[model samples]
Target: MDIVISIASKIAESLVTPIGREFGYLIYYDTNMKDLKDELKQLFEMKDRVQESVKAAKRNGEVINYDVQSWQTSVDKLIQKVLHFEEEVSMKRRCLYRWNISRKATKITQDVLYLQKEGTFNNVAHPAPPPMIWSTFKEGFKDFKSRMTHVNRVTEVLKNEEVRMIGICGMGGCG
Candidate 1:
């Protein structure tokens, strides 16, 4: 009797879970859509603020951070998804349709909330590092004798007032 009851209960539970989840989807359809729309509006506001920062940073010749740029890209893609979902959900006709749409709306609502949280970037950008700049000093010299002569020569040449151009030409590209 105990073994039979355990097997029956397991089978019953497996059947009820999906049905209950679908029912919940139906029940929460309107609420989820409203929350999704509200959250998306807030996300848009954040997007605008971030975009303004990007614009200002560009004006000041600053390079936007990689993560900030990536976030904006994700926002652009999500915009398309939201537009399509909103249009599709507006004409709710069938129970199955609402069930699936509600599920998607719930997922999108969560996504929108996540993006809104991520949009709070403290620093959008910074001045770009100068071109061809290197940190040879920090790493230290591997061959001090060979490299130091070249370094000292270049430094000495740079200090000379009369030398207007430097052309360190050598066989096998020693410079």
Candidate 2:
């Protein structure tokens, strides 16, 4: 019985940690895309509830109930979907980057041809616009901003200044 409980605890920890990490990434991605935010938010909430249920079961020294298992299964499926969505987004970004590079190269070639035909390189009035910003760093920062807002709200409710300071510092470091 002891071994069984230990194994269950380990399994729950392993599953919960990855799910949380994946949910965090999904949230970060959704910050700019906004397409998956609502669905991911629902999954996150469900994960939280499932985690609470597991904790409760552990505290009571009871085996996880069927309802908890069902919740866990649903969360697992949602996480898988989120991962698939991320992969699709990455592929799309790569294709867009290639397209942008090709377009810029073609424009540069045309400009050079015109310069050669006109026999003047001195009258170019405007430089090409900067390449499309492909990195998702901006979206990630927006996600961080939202997380910071939550941290601030939690800190405001904390009675201990030292603890609040630590929490804020911890969140900043994570960012």
Candidate 3:
């Protein structure tokens, strides 16, 4: 009986740890996409605001008196450009997030299977870390480090994409 219990505990430990990590990945993917979805919504709102601004600029009599056709043309072009850039960025971000999630899920599943073979199957039963939980490479966090790195890269790309859009708009306004 003691021998059986000992083997069972060992098997449980081996199975649980990997399971824990995989479950963590699943939670992270869900939370991360939801966060990104929120950002996309904000971007959409900003796009609407930009459109409104263009409309208001077109309707202002004094502005039209000063540079009517040119101003309207510039505003329309700028609005279109900004919107196009934003749409491209949003699409790219969404696609990258999806790809990362699918990749993470697969990796975690494999890890779980591997751990089951080794013993701690139930360790990953809990929700995973939040999207922004940056783990140190040396912290022994396992398969998640790679996925986290991918998430960070996507974040950076989104940041740069936003910056690019803002810079273009700023320059257009000045010109």
The sequence of per-residue lDDT tens digits that candidate 3 reaches over residues 83-116 is: 5644654565464555556444354344333322
Backbone collisions counted per model: 0, 0, 16
lDDT of 3 at 67: 32
lDDT of 1 by residue, 51-143 (tens): 999999999889999999999999999999998887887776698998899899989988888888888899999998778966545654466
Query: What TM-score do all the candidates reach, one by one?
Result: 0.68, 0.32, 0.25
Best by TM-score: 1
TM-score for candidate 3, residues paired by index: 0.25
Off by over 4 Å in 3: 1-27, 61-99, 102-175
How far off is residue 91 in model 3, in Å? 15
* Whole-model lDDT values for every prediction: 0.88, 0.53, 0.49
What lDDT score is found at residue 72 in candidate 1?
A: 98
Tens-place lDDT digits, model 2, residues 1-175: 9999999999999999878755554344424344344445655665665577567656755556554565467556646755665565566655445443333333333433332343322221233356696764545444578677877887676856667344334534355
Local distance difference test, candidate 2: 0.53
